[model samples]
Target: MNKKAIVTAGLAAALSIGAISTAQAASKEKCYGIAKAGQNDCANISGTHSCAGQSKTDNALDDWKAVKAGTCEEMGGYSKAQAKELLKKQKEMKG
Candidate 1:
Protein backbone atom coordinates (compact mmCIF):
# COMPACT_ATOMS: atom_id res chain seq x y z
CA MET A 1 0.00 0.00 0.00
CA ASN A 2 1.05 3.59 -0.46
CA LYS A 3 2.16 5.70 2.51
CA LYS A 4 -1.03 7.76 2.40
CA ALA A 5 -3.20 4.64 2.37
CA ILE A 6 -1.30 3.14 5.32
CA VAL A 7 -1.71 6.29 7.39
CA THR A 8 -5.41 6.54 6.60
CA ALA A 9 -5.94 2.91 7.57
CA GLY A 10 -4.08 3.40 10.84
CA LEU A 11 -6.09 6.47 11.74
CA ALA A 12 -9.37 4.73 10.98
CA ALA A 13 -8.39 1.77 13.12
CA ALA A 14 -7.50 4.03 16.04
CA LEU A 15 -10.76 5.89 15.80
CA SER A 16 -12.77 2.69 15.71
CA ILE A 17 -10.98 1.41 18.76
CA GLY A 18 -11.74 4.60 20.62
CA ALA A 19 -15.41 4.37 19.68
CA ILE A 20 -15.61 0.81 20.92
CA SER A 21 -14.11 1.77 24.25
CA THR A 22 -16.46 4.69 24.57
CA ALA A 23 -19.40 2.38 24.01
CA GLN A 24 -18.09 0.05 26.66
CA ALA A 25 -17.73 2.92 29.12
CA ALA A 26 -21.33 3.86 28.49
CA SER A 27 -22.27 0.47 29.87
CA LYS A 28 -20.36 1.09 33.07
CA GLU A 29 -21.54 2.81 36.24
CA LYS A 30 -19.53 4.37 39.05
CA CYS A 31 -19.80 2.19 42.14
CA TYR A 32 -18.97 4.06 45.29
CA GLY A 33 -17.06 2.49 48.18
CA ILE A 34 -15.75 -0.30 46.01
CA ALA A 35 -12.36 1.05 45.11
CA LYS A 36 -9.31 -0.12 46.93
CA ALA A 37 -6.73 2.48 47.84
CA GLY A 38 -5.44 4.16 44.68
CA GLN A 39 -7.83 2.22 42.48
CA ASN A 40 -10.52 4.80 41.96
CA ASP A 41 -11.76 5.62 38.48
CA CYS A 42 -11.89 9.39 38.96
CA ALA A 43 -11.98 12.16 41.51
CA ASN A 44 -13.55 11.27 44.84
CA ILE A 45 -16.84 12.76 45.92
CA SER A 46 -15.20 14.56 48.83
CA GLY A 47 -12.75 16.31 46.50
CA THR A 48 -9.76 15.40 48.59
CA HIS A 49 -8.13 14.56 45.26
CA SER A 50 -8.91 15.31 41.64
CA CYS A 51 -7.63 12.42 39.61
CA ALA A 52 -7.99 8.75 39.07
CA GLY A 53 -5.98 6.36 41.22
CA GLN A 54 -5.53 8.96 43.94
CA SER A 55 -7.76 7.52 46.64
CA LYS A 56 -5.94 7.26 49.96
CA THR A 57 -8.30 4.83 51.61
CA ASP A 58 -9.79 1.59 50.56
CA ASN A 59 -13.53 1.57 50.07
CA ALA A 60 -13.97 5.16 51.13
CA LEU A 61 -17.58 6.35 50.91
CA ASP A 62 -16.55 9.14 48.55
CA ASP A 63 -14.31 7.05 46.31
CA TRP A 64 -15.62 5.07 43.38
CA LYS A 65 -14.59 2.71 40.63
CA ALA A 66 -16.43 1.85 37.50
CA VAL A 67 -18.19 -1.47 37.54
CA LYS A 68 -20.56 -3.01 35.07
CA ALA A 69 -23.98 -1.44 35.20
CA GLY A 70 -26.53 -3.18 37.46
CA THR A 71 -23.85 -5.02 39.43
CA CYS A 72 -22.80 -2.38 41.96
CA GLU A 73 -25.18 -3.33 44.74
CA GLU A 74 -24.46 -6.99 44.18
CA MET A 75 -20.82 -6.15 44.66
CA GLY A 76 -21.62 -4.22 47.87
CA GLY A 77 -21.03 -0.81 46.41
CA TYR A 78 -23.38 2.14 46.74
CA SER A 79 -24.75 4.38 44.01
CA LYS A 80 -23.82 8.04 44.00
CA ALA A 81 -27.11 9.00 45.58
CA GLN A 82 -26.76 6.44 48.31
CA ALA A 83 -23.20 7.51 49.01
CA LYS A 84 -24.23 11.12 49.19
CA GLU A 85 -27.04 10.37 51.59
CA LEU A 86 -24.77 8.32 53.77
CA LEU A 87 -22.14 11.03 53.80
CA LYS A 88 -24.73 13.59 54.79
CA LYS A 89 -25.87 11.37 57.62
CA GLN A 90 -22.29 10.98 58.78
CA LYS A 91 -21.76 14.72 58.83
CA GLU A 92 -24.96 15.30 60.76
CA MET A 93 -24.00 12.72 63.33
CA LYS A 94 -20.60 14.31 63.76
CA GLY A 95 -22.09 17.70 64.60
Candidate 2:
Protein backbone atom coordinates (compact mmCIF):
# COMPACT_ATOMS: atom_id res chain seq x y z
CA MET A 1 0.00 0.00 0.00
CA ASN A 2 0.96 3.63 -0.35
CA LYS A 3 2.45 5.41 2.68
CA LYS A 4 -0.65 7.53 3.19
CA ALA A 5 -2.89 4.49 2.96
CA ILE A 6 -0.79 2.59 5.48
CA VAL A 7 -0.94 5.44 7.94
CA THR A 8 -4.68 5.70 7.58
CA ALA A 9 -5.06 1.98 8.14
CA GLY A 10 -2.96 2.08 11.28
CA LEU A 11 -5.01 4.91 12.72
CA ALA A 12 -8.20 3.09 11.89
CA ALA A 13 -6.93 -0.04 13.60
CA ALA A 14 -6.02 1.90 16.73
CA LEU A 15 -9.43 3.53 16.85
CA SER A 16 -11.12 0.18 16.41
CA ILE A 17 -9.22 -1.32 19.31
CA GLY A 18 -10.06 1.62 21.53
CA ALA A 19 -13.73 1.29 20.76
CA ILE A 20 -13.73 -2.41 21.49
CA SER A 21 -12.02 -1.94 24.83
CA THR A 22 -14.49 0.73 25.86
CA ALA A 23 -17.45 -1.40 24.88
CA GLN A 24 -16.08 -4.40 26.70
CA ALA A 25 -15.51 -2.37 29.83
CA ALA A 26 -19.06 -1.13 29.72
CA SER A 27 -20.42 -4.67 29.55
CA LYS A 28 -18.67 -5.83 32.72
CA GLU A 29 -21.61 -6.48 35.03
CA LYS A 30 -22.15 -5.93 38.75
CA CYS A 31 -24.13 -8.19 41.02
CA TYR A 32 -25.85 -7.83 44.41
CA GLY A 33 -24.86 -11.18 45.80
CA ILE A 34 -24.03 -14.80 45.13
CA ALA A 35 -27.63 -15.93 44.74
CA LYS A 36 -28.56 -13.09 42.47
CA ALA A 37 -26.32 -13.18 39.45
CA GLY A 38 -28.31 -12.11 36.42
CA GLN A 39 -30.34 -9.25 37.74
CA ASN A 40 -29.05 -5.75 36.92
CA ASP A 41 -31.09 -3.47 39.09
CA CYS A 42 -29.14 -2.03 42.02
CA ALA A 43 -32.19 -0.98 43.98
CA ASN A 44 -33.57 -4.43 44.61
CA ILE A 45 -30.33 -5.76 46.05
CA SER A 46 -29.87 -2.80 48.35
CA GLY A 47 -33.47 -2.77 49.44
CA THR A 48 -33.63 -6.46 50.20
CA HIS A 49 -30.04 -7.33 50.98
CA SER A 50 -28.59 -4.04 52.15
CA CYS A 51 -26.14 -4.13 49.30
CA ALA A 52 -25.87 -2.70 45.84
CA GLY A 53 -23.59 -4.27 43.29
CA GLN A 54 -22.02 -4.77 39.92
CA SER A 55 -20.32 -7.65 38.12
CA LYS A 56 -17.64 -8.31 35.60
CA THR A 57 -17.32 -11.74 34.12
CA ASP A 58 -14.10 -13.66 34.71
CA ASN A 59 -12.24 -11.23 32.49
CA ALA A 60 -13.45 -7.81 33.60
CA LEU A 61 -12.26 -7.12 37.11
CA ASP A 62 -11.24 -3.47 36.96
CA ASP A 63 -14.32 -2.34 35.15
CA TRP A 64 -16.61 -4.40 37.30
CA LYS A 65 -15.09 -3.18 40.55
CA ALA A 66 -15.14 0.43 39.52
CA VAL A 67 -18.62 0.46 38.10
CA LYS A 68 -20.02 -1.40 41.04
CA ALA A 69 -18.50 1.12 43.40
CA GLY A 70 -19.98 4.07 41.60
CA THR A 71 -23.35 2.67 40.69
CA CYS A 72 -24.26 0.09 43.30
CA GLU A 73 -25.51 2.75 45.66
CA GLU A 74 -28.75 2.83 43.73
CA MET A 75 -29.76 -0.32 45.54
CA GLY A 76 -32.00 1.73 47.90
CA GLY A 77 -30.19 1.05 51.17
CA TYR A 78 -26.51 0.26 50.74
CA SER A 79 -23.56 2.45 51.41
CA LYS A 80 -20.74 2.28 48.86
CA ALA A 81 -18.62 0.24 51.20
CA GLN A 82 -21.31 -2.36 51.73
CA ALA A 83 -21.93 -2.62 48.04
CA LYS A 84 -18.24 -3.17 47.38
CA GLU A 85 -17.91 -5.83 50.03
CA LEU A 86 -20.96 -7.64 48.78
CA LEU A 87 -19.57 -7.65 45.29
CA LYS A 88 -16.21 -8.91 46.54
CA LYS A 89 -17.80 -11.79 48.37
CA GLN A 90 -19.88 -12.69 45.38
CA LYS A 91 -16.80 -12.79 43.21
CA GLU A 92 -14.96 -14.96 45.66
CA MET A 93 -17.86 -17.34 46.00
CA LYS A 94 -18.11 -17.64 42.27
CA GLY A 95 -14.51 -18.80 42.23
Candidate 3:
Protein backbone atom coordinates (compact mmCIF):
# COMPACT_ATOMS: atom_id res chain seq x y z
CA MET A 1 0.00 0.00 0.00
CA ASN A 2 1.16 3.57 -0.69
CA LYS A 3 1.91 6.04 2.14
CA LYS A 4 -1.21 8.03 1.35
CA ALA A 5 -3.44 4.96 1.48
CA ILE A 6 -1.90 3.86 4.79
CA VAL A 7 -2.44 7.28 6.32
CA THR A 8 -6.04 7.41 5.15
CA ALA A 9 -6.70 3.98 6.57
CA GLY A 10 -5.23 4.97 9.91
CA LEU A 11 -7.36 8.09 10.03
CA ALA A 12 -10.46 6.12 9.24
CA ALA A 13 -9.67 3.66 12.00
CA ALA A 14 -9.16 6.43 14.52
CA LEU A 15 -12.44 8.05 13.61
CA SER A 16 -14.28 4.77 13.95
CA ILE A 17 -12.80 4.18 17.36
CA GLY A 18 -13.92 7.61 18.49
CA ALA A 19 -17.43 6.93 17.26
CA ILE A 20 -17.52 3.62 19.10
CA SER A 21 -16.52 5.22 22.37
CA THR A 22 -19.06 7.98 21.95
CA ALA A 23 -21.79 5.42 21.41
CA GLN A 24 -20.69 3.50 24.44
CA ALA A 25 -20.76 6.63 26.56
CA ALA A 26 -24.26 7.38 25.38
CA SER A 27 -25.29 4.10 26.98
CA LYS A 28 -23.56 4.89 30.22
CA GLU A 29 -24.55 6.81 33.36
CA LYS A 30 -22.52 8.35 36.13
CA CYS A 31 -22.48 6.30 39.34
CA TYR A 32 -21.41 8.11 42.45
CA GLY A 33 -19.47 6.81 45.47
CA ILE A 34 -18.04 3.92 43.55
CA ALA A 35 -14.82 5.17 42.04
CA LYS A 36 -11.59 4.16 43.68
CA ALA A 37 -9.07 6.89 44.46
CA GLY A 38 -7.77 8.52 41.29
CA GLN A 39 -10.19 6.61 39.13
CA ASN A 40 -13.07 9.00 38.80
CA ASP A 41 -14.34 9.81 35.33
CA CYS A 42 -14.81 13.51 36.05
CA ALA A 43 -14.89 16.10 38.80
CA ASN A 44 -16.45 15.22 42.13
CA ILE A 45 -19.53 16.74 43.64
CA SER A 46 -17.51 18.54 46.29
CA GLY A 47 -15.61 20.57 43.69
CA THR A 48 -12.23 19.72 45.11
CA HIS A 49 -10.86 19.09 41.60
CA SER A 50 -12.03 19.86 38.11
CA CYS A 51 -10.70 16.87 36.17
CA ALA A 52 -10.74 13.14 35.96
CA GLY A 53 -8.53 10.95 38.16
CA GLN A 54 -8.29 13.49 40.96
CA SER A 55 -10.17 11.85 43.81
CA LYS A 56 -8.15 11.62 46.97
CA THR A 57 -10.30 9.03 48.72
CA ASP A 58 -11.54 5.72 47.59
CA ASN A 59 -15.27 5.48 47.17
CA ALA A 60 -15.74 9.10 48.17
CA LEU A 61 -19.40 10.01 48.18
CA ASP A 62 -18.69 12.95 45.93
CA ASP A 63 -16.63 11.10 43.35
CA TRP A 64 -18.18 9.23 40.50
CA LYS A 65 -17.42 6.95 37.59
CA ALA A 66 -19.33 6.02 34.54
CA VAL A 67 -21.05 2.67 34.56
CA LYS A 68 -23.46 0.94 32.29
CA ALA A 69 -26.92 2.38 32.53
CA GLY A 70 -29.16 0.68 35.13
CA THR A 71 -26.18 -1.11 36.72
CA CYS A 72 -24.94 1.47 39.21
CA GLU A 73 -27.42 0.46 41.90
CA GLU A 74 -26.36 -3.13 41.57
CA MET A 75 -22.80 -2.00 42.05
CA GLY A 76 -23.76 -0.13 45.26
CA GLY A 77 -23.29 3.27 43.71
CA TYR A 78 -25.35 6.36 44.49
CA SER A 79 -27.33 8.64 42.25
CA LYS A 80 -26.46 12.32 42.01
CA ALA A 81 -29.07 13.30 44.56
CA GLN A 82 -27.99 10.65 47.01
CA ALA A 83 -24.33 11.49 46.65
CA LYS A 84 -25.03 15.16 47.18
CA GLU A 85 -27.03 14.44 50.31
CA LEU A 86 -24.41 12.12 51.66
CA LEU A 87 -21.61 14.58 50.97
CA LYS A 88 -23.58 17.29 52.73
CA LYS A 89 -23.94 15.14 55.80
CA GLN A 90 -20.31 14.20 55.70
CA LYS A 91 -19.21 17.82 55.60
CA GLU A 92 -21.50 18.77 58.43
CA MET A 93 -20.22 15.97 60.59
CA LYS A 94 -16.60 16.93 59.95
CA GLY A 95 -17.15 20.56 61.05
Candidate 4:
Protein backbone atom coordinates (compact mmCIF):
# COMPACT_ATOMS: atom_id res chain seq x y z
CA MET A 1 0.00 0.00 0.00
CA ASN A 2 1.02 3.62 -0.52
CA LYS A 3 2.49 5.62 2.38
CA LYS A 4 -0.65 7.77 2.72
CA ALA A 5 -2.92 4.71 2.78
CA ILE A 6 -0.76 3.00 5.42
CA VAL A 7 -0.81 6.06 7.67
CA THR A 8 -4.57 6.44 7.28
CA ALA A 9 -5.11 2.82 8.16
CA GLY A 10 -2.94 3.11 11.24
CA LEU A 11 -4.80 6.19 12.45
CA ALA A 12 -8.11 4.52 11.87
CA ALA A 13 -7.06 1.51 13.87
CA ALA A 14 -5.89 3.68 16.76
CA LEU A 15 -9.15 5.61 16.78
CA SER A 16 -11.18 2.44 16.74
CA ILE A 17 -9.28 1.06 19.73
CA GLY A 18 -9.74 4.27 21.64
CA ALA A 19 -13.47 4.32 20.93
CA ILE A 20 -13.86 0.76 22.11
CA SER A 21 -11.98 1.49 25.32
CA THR A 22 -14.13 4.52 26.05
CA ALA A 23 -17.30 2.61 25.44
CA GLN A 24 -16.27 -0.21 27.74
CA ALA A 25 -15.25 2.18 30.48
CA ALA A 26 -18.47 4.10 30.18
CA SER A 27 -20.56 0.99 30.45
CA LYS A 28 -18.81 -0.62 33.42
CA GLU A 29 -19.12 0.51 37.02
CA LYS A 30 -17.58 -0.62 40.29
CA CYS A 31 -20.31 -2.33 42.21
CA TYR A 32 -20.06 -3.53 45.80
CA GLY A 33 -22.14 -6.02 47.75
CA ILE A 34 -22.88 -8.26 44.79
CA ALA A 35 -19.83 -10.36 44.25
CA LYS A 36 -20.20 -13.94 45.31
CA ALA A 37 -17.65 -15.68 47.47
CA GLY A 38 -14.30 -15.89 45.73
CA GLN A 39 -15.70 -13.98 42.77
CA ASN A 40 -14.68 -10.39 43.27
CA ASP A 41 -13.25 -8.44 40.36
CA CYS A 42 -10.20 -7.00 42.12
CA ALA A 43 -8.73 -5.75 45.40
CA ASN A 44 -10.87 -5.01 48.38
CA ILE A 45 -10.85 -1.70 50.25
CA SER A 46 -9.79 -3.45 53.47
CA GLY A 47 -6.56 -4.72 51.88
CA THR A 48 -7.51 -8.30 52.56
CA HIS A 49 -7.06 -9.41 48.96
CA SER A 50 -5.57 -8.18 45.71
CA CYS A 51 -6.93 -10.54 43.09
CA ALA A 52 -10.17 -11.63 41.57
CA GLY A 53 -11.94 -14.68 42.94
CA GLN A 54 -10.19 -14.41 46.28
CA SER A 55 -12.90 -13.01 48.47
CA LYS A 56 -13.85 -15.17 51.43
CA THR A 57 -17.14 -13.49 51.99
CA ASP A 58 -20.02 -12.66 49.73
CA ASN A 59 -21.57 -9.21 49.49
CA ALA A 60 -18.69 -7.56 51.29
CA LEU A 61 -18.74 -3.78 51.26
CA ASP A 62 -14.99 -3.71 50.88
CA ASP A 63 -15.12 -5.95 47.86
CA TRP A 64 -16.20 -4.65 44.50
CA LYS A 65 -17.03 -6.28 41.21
CA ALA A 66 -17.60 -4.61 37.91
CA VAL A 67 -21.13 -4.61 36.65
CA LYS A 68 -22.90 -2.76 33.89
CA ALA A 69 -23.38 0.87 34.76
CA GLY A 70 -26.90 1.92 35.86
CA THR A 71 -27.72 -1.68 36.73
CA CYS A 72 -25.87 -2.10 40.00
CA GLU A 73 -28.82 -1.23 42.15
CA GLU A 74 -31.05 -3.49 40.17
CA MET A 75 -28.58 -6.31 40.71
CA GLY A 76 -28.42 -5.65 44.48
CA GLY A 77 -25.03 -4.03 44.23
CA TYR A 78 -24.13 -0.82 45.98
CA SER A 79 -22.63 2.25 44.39
CA LYS A 80 -19.32 3.52 45.73
CA ALA A 81 -20.99 6.18 47.81
CA GLN A 82 -23.49 3.77 49.25
CA ALA A 83 -20.85 1.23 50.03
CA LYS A 84 -18.81 3.79 51.89
CA GLU A 85 -21.82 4.69 53.95
CA LEU A 86 -22.44 1.06 54.74
CA LEU A 87 -18.87 0.62 55.80
CA LYS A 88 -19.15 3.59 58.09
CA LYS A 89 -22.24 2.15 59.67
CA GLN A 90 -20.55 -1.16 60.20
CA LYS A 91 -17.62 0.50 61.84
CA GLU A 92 -19.92 2.42 64.13
CA MET A 93 -21.73 -0.71 65.10
CA LYS A 94 -18.51 -2.50 65.84
CA GLY A 95 -17.21 0.39 67.93
Candidate 5:
Protein backbone atom coordinates (compact mmCIF):
# COMPACT_ATOMS: atom_id res chain seq x y z
CA MET A 1 0.00 0.00 0.00
CA ASN A 2 1.04 3.61 -0.49
CA LYS A 3 2.44 5.50 2.52
CA LYS A 4 -0.41 8.00 2.47
CA ALA A 5 -3.00 5.25 2.37
CA ILE A 6 -1.34 3.48 5.31
CA VAL A 7 -1.35 6.65 7.36
CA THR A 8 -4.96 7.31 6.58
CA ALA A 9 -5.88 3.82 7.65
CA GLY A 10 -4.02 4.24 10.93
CA LEU A 11 -5.77 7.50 11.65
CA ALA A 12 -9.14 5.98 10.91
CA ALA A 13 -8.42 3.09 13.23
CA ALA A 14 -7.42 5.42 16.04
CA LEU A 15 -10.56 7.49 15.63
CA SER A 16 -12.71 4.38 15.60
CA ILE A 17 -11.13 3.17 18.85
CA GLY A 18 -11.66 6.53 20.47
CA ALA A 19 -15.32 6.57 19.49
CA ILE A 20 -15.85 3.10 20.89
CA SER A 21 -14.25 4.05 24.17
CA THR A 22 -16.42 7.14 24.46
CA ALA A 23 -19.55 5.16 23.84
CA GLN A 24 -18.65 2.60 26.47
CA ALA A 25 -17.91 5.29 29.01
CA ALA A 26 -21.18 7.06 28.29
CA SER A 27 -23.12 3.92 29.01
CA LYS A 28 -21.42 3.16 32.30
CA GLU A 29 -21.95 4.66 35.75
CA LYS A 30 -19.52 4.63 38.63
CA CYS A 31 -21.18 2.41 41.20
CA TYR A 32 -19.70 2.09 44.65
CA GLY A 33 -19.98 -0.60 47.32
CA ILE A 34 -20.94 -3.41 45.03
CA ALA A 35 -17.89 -4.73 43.25
CA LYS A 36 -16.49 -8.07 44.30
CA ALA A 37 -12.86 -8.60 45.10
CA GLY A 38 -10.66 -8.10 42.06
CA GLN A 39 -13.63 -6.89 40.06
CA ASN A 40 -13.55 -3.10 40.22
CA ASP A 41 -13.93 -1.02 37.08
CA CYS A 42 -10.89 1.14 37.77
CA ALA A 43 -8.55 2.39 40.49
CA ASN A 44 -9.58 3.07 44.03
CA ILE A 45 -10.11 6.60 45.33
CA SER A 46 -7.05 6.34 47.57
CA GLY A 47 -4.71 5.81 44.61
CA THR A 48 -3.70 2.47 45.98
CA HIS A 49 -3.94 0.82 42.55
CA SER A 50 -4.62 1.40 38.88
CA CYS A 51 -6.80 -0.40 36.30
CA ALA A 52 -9.65 -2.79 36.70
CA GLY A 53 -9.75 -6.09 38.57
CA GLN A 54 -7.71 -4.75 41.47
CA SER A 55 -10.15 -4.22 44.29
CA LYS A 56 -9.03 -5.81 47.55
CA THR A 57 -12.42 -6.25 49.10
CA ASP A 58 -16.04 -6.56 48.16
CA ASN A 59 -18.26 -3.53 48.82
CA ALA A 60 -15.41 -1.16 49.62
CA LEU A 61 -16.92 2.33 49.56
CA ASP A 62 -13.75 3.88 48.19
CA ASP A 63 -13.70 1.45 45.30
CA TRP A 64 -16.18 1.52 42.47
CA LYS A 65 -17.29 -0.53 39.53
CA ALA A 66 -18.93 0.51 36.30
CA VAL A 67 -22.54 -0.45 35.99
CA LYS A 68 -25.35 0.66 33.74
CA ALA A 69 -27.05 3.80 35.01
CA GLY A 70 -30.44 3.26 36.68
CA THR A 71 -29.42 -0.31 37.46
CA CYS A 72 -26.79 0.13 40.13
CA GLU A 73 -29.22 0.38 43.00
CA GLU A 74 -30.93 -2.75 41.83
CA MET A 75 -27.59 -4.46 41.93
CA GLY A 76 -26.89 -3.19 45.44
CA GLY A 77 -24.51 -0.47 44.38
CA TYR A 78 -24.36 3.07 45.75
CA SER A 79 -24.28 6.29 43.79
CA LYS A 80 -21.43 8.70 44.43
CA ALA A 81 -23.44 10.75 46.89
CA GLN A 82 -24.68 7.70 48.73
CA ALA A 83 -21.24 6.23 48.80
CA LYS A 84 -19.90 9.32 50.50
CA GLU A 85 -22.52 9.00 53.21
CA LEU A 86 -21.67 5.36 53.70
CA LEU A 87 -17.99 6.16 53.96
CA LYS A 88 -18.72 8.75 56.59
CA LYS A 89 -20.72 6.25 58.62
CA GLN A 90 -17.98 3.71 58.37
CA LYS A 91 -15.38 6.20 59.57
CA GLU A 92 -17.57 7.19 62.48
CA MET A 93 -17.94 3.58 63.52
CA LYS A 94 -14.23 2.99 63.33
CA GLY A 95 -13.25 6.10 65.27
Candidate 6:
Protein backbone atom coordinates (compact mmCIF):
# COMPACT_ATOMS: atom_id res chain seq x y z
CA MET A 1 0.00 0.00 0.00
CA ASN A 2 1.04 3.62 -0.52
CA LYS A 3 2.46 5.58 2.41
CA LYS A 4 -0.76 7.58 2.68
CA ALA A 5 -2.90 4.42 2.85
CA ILE A 6 -0.59 2.85 5.43
CA VAL A 7 -0.78 5.99 7.57
CA THR A 8 -4.55 5.98 7.39
CA ALA A 9 -4.72 2.35 8.45
CA GLY A 10 -2.36 2.99 11.32
CA LEU A 11 -4.46 5.95 12.48
CA ALA A 12 -7.61 3.86 12.34
CA ALA A 13 -6.04 1.09 14.38
CA ALA A 14 -4.82 3.58 16.96
CA LEU A 15 -8.25 5.14 17.26
CA SER A 16 -9.87 1.74 17.72
CA ILE A 17 -7.40 0.82 20.44
CA GLY A 18 -8.04 4.09 22.22
CA ALA A 19 -11.78 3.56 22.16
CA ILE A 20 -11.46 0.00 23.52
CA SER A 21 -9.20 1.14 26.31
CA THR A 22 -11.67 3.82 27.33
CA ALA A 23 -14.50 1.31 27.48
CA GLN A 24 -12.46 -1.12 29.53
CA ALA A 25 -11.65 1.61 31.98
CA ALA A 26 -15.31 2.43 32.30
CA SER A 27 -16.19 -1.19 33.00
CA LYS A 28 -13.55 -1.37 35.69
CA GLU A 29 -15.26 1.46 37.53
CA LYS A 30 -18.33 -0.73 37.94
CA CYS A 31 -16.38 -3.41 39.81
CA TYR A 32 -17.68 -2.18 43.12
CA GLY A 33 -21.27 -3.27 43.57
CA ILE A 34 -23.93 -3.17 46.28
CA ALA A 35 -22.16 -6.02 48.08
CA LYS A 36 -19.28 -3.69 48.84
CA ALA A 37 -21.47 -0.77 49.83
CA GLY A 38 -22.57 -2.55 53.03
CA GLN A 39 -26.13 -1.59 52.35
CA ASN A 40 -27.88 -0.90 49.10
CA ASP A 41 -27.85 2.78 50.15
CA CYS A 42 -24.67 3.47 48.12
CA ALA A 43 -23.82 6.28 50.56
CA ASN A 44 -23.66 4.04 53.60
CA ILE A 45 -21.73 1.54 51.50
CA SER A 46 -18.51 3.42 52.08
CA GLY A 47 -16.66 2.51 55.30
CA THR A 48 -14.46 5.58 55.61
CA HIS A 49 -17.27 7.71 56.90
CA SER A 50 -16.27 9.98 54.03
CA CYS A 51 -19.92 10.42 53.22
CA ALA A 52 -20.72 11.14 56.83
CA GLY A 53 -21.24 14.86 56.36
CA GLN A 54 -22.93 14.61 52.98
CA SER A 55 -26.61 14.33 52.23
CA LYS A 56 -28.21 10.92 51.73
CA THR A 57 -28.93 11.41 48.02
CA ASP A 58 -25.40 12.44 47.06
CA ASN A 59 -24.33 8.80 46.83
CA ALA A 60 -26.94 8.04 44.26
CA LEU A 61 -25.47 7.15 40.85
CA ASP A 62 -27.22 10.17 39.27
CA ASP A 63 -26.31 12.61 42.01
CA TRP A 64 -22.93 14.24 42.68
CA LYS A 65 -21.24 11.19 41.12
CA ALA A 66 -18.40 9.09 42.49
CA VAL A 67 -17.69 8.50 46.14
CA LYS A 68 -14.87 8.92 48.56
CA ALA A 69 -12.46 5.96 48.82
CA GLY A 70 -13.44 4.69 52.17
CA THR A 71 -12.48 1.22 53.30
CA CYS A 72 -12.39 -0.85 50.09
CA GLU A 73 -13.03 -4.01 52.10
CA GLU A 74 -16.32 -2.74 53.40
CA MET A 75 -17.22 -2.13 57.04
CA GLY A 76 -20.68 -0.72 57.27
CA GLY A 77 -21.48 -1.52 53.66
CA TYR A 78 -20.43 -3.37 50.52
CA SER A 79 -18.27 -6.48 50.04
CA LYS A 80 -14.55 -6.51 49.34
CA ALA A 81 -14.75 -6.61 45.56
CA GLN A 82 -17.94 -4.56 45.49
CA ALA A 83 -16.53 -1.84 47.74
CA LYS A 84 -13.45 -1.61 45.59
CA GLU A 85 -15.48 -0.78 42.50
CA LEU A 86 -17.77 1.57 44.39
CA LEU A 87 -14.77 3.53 45.57
CA LYS A 88 -13.46 3.79 42.02
CA LYS A 89 -16.81 4.85 40.63
CA GLN A 90 -17.20 7.32 43.46
CA LYS A 91 -13.87 8.92 42.68
CA GLU A 92 -14.50 9.00 38.91
CA MET A 93 -17.94 10.50 39.36
CA LYS A 94 -16.67 13.01 41.90
CA GLY A 95 -14.21 14.29 39.34
Candidate that scores best on TM-score: 1
Residue range with the least summed lDDT across 10 consecutive positions in model 6: 58-67
Candidate 6 structure quality by residue, lDDT tens digits, 1-95: 89999999999999999999777655542213323222332234444344423434323322122223454324233444555676687799999
Candidate 6 lDDT (Cα, whole model)? 0.46
Each model's lDDT comes to 0.95, 0.48, 0.94, 0.91, 0.88, 0.46
**27 Cα displacement, candidate 6 (Å):** 0.6
Model 3 agreement with the true structure over 1-95: per-residue lDDT tens digits: 99999999999999999999999989999999999999999988878899999999899889999999999999999999999998888889999
Local distance difference test, candidate 5: 0.88
Q: Which residue pairs in candidate 4 collide?
A: none
RMSD of each: 1.4, 10.8, 2.8, 2.0, 1.8, 12.6
Candidate 4 overall Cα lDDT vs. reference?
0.91
Q: Candidate 2 lDDT, tens digit per residue, 1-95?
A: 89999999999999999999888768654533322342233344323423234432322212222243345445333444565676678889999
> Which digits, one per residue and each the tens of the lDDT, describe model 4 over residues 1-95?
99999999999999999999999989999999999899999998778889999999889988999988899999988988888899999999999
Model 5, 4-77: lDDT tens digits are 99999999999999999999889989998888999998887667888899988988887898888788889888
Q: Is candidate 2 or candidate 4 better by TM-score?
A: 4
Task: Estimate the TM-score for candidate 1.
Answer: 0.88
Error of 2 at 84 (Å): 5.9
Task: Give the deviation of candidate 5 from the true structure as CA RMSD.
Answer: 1.8
> TM-score of model 6 relative to the true fold?
0.34
Worst 10 residues of 2 by lDDT: 56-65
Per lDDT, the best of the predicted structures is 1
TM-score per candidate, chains pooled: 0.88, 0.36, 0.74, 0.79, 0.83, 0.34
Quote the lDDT for 2 in model 6: 100
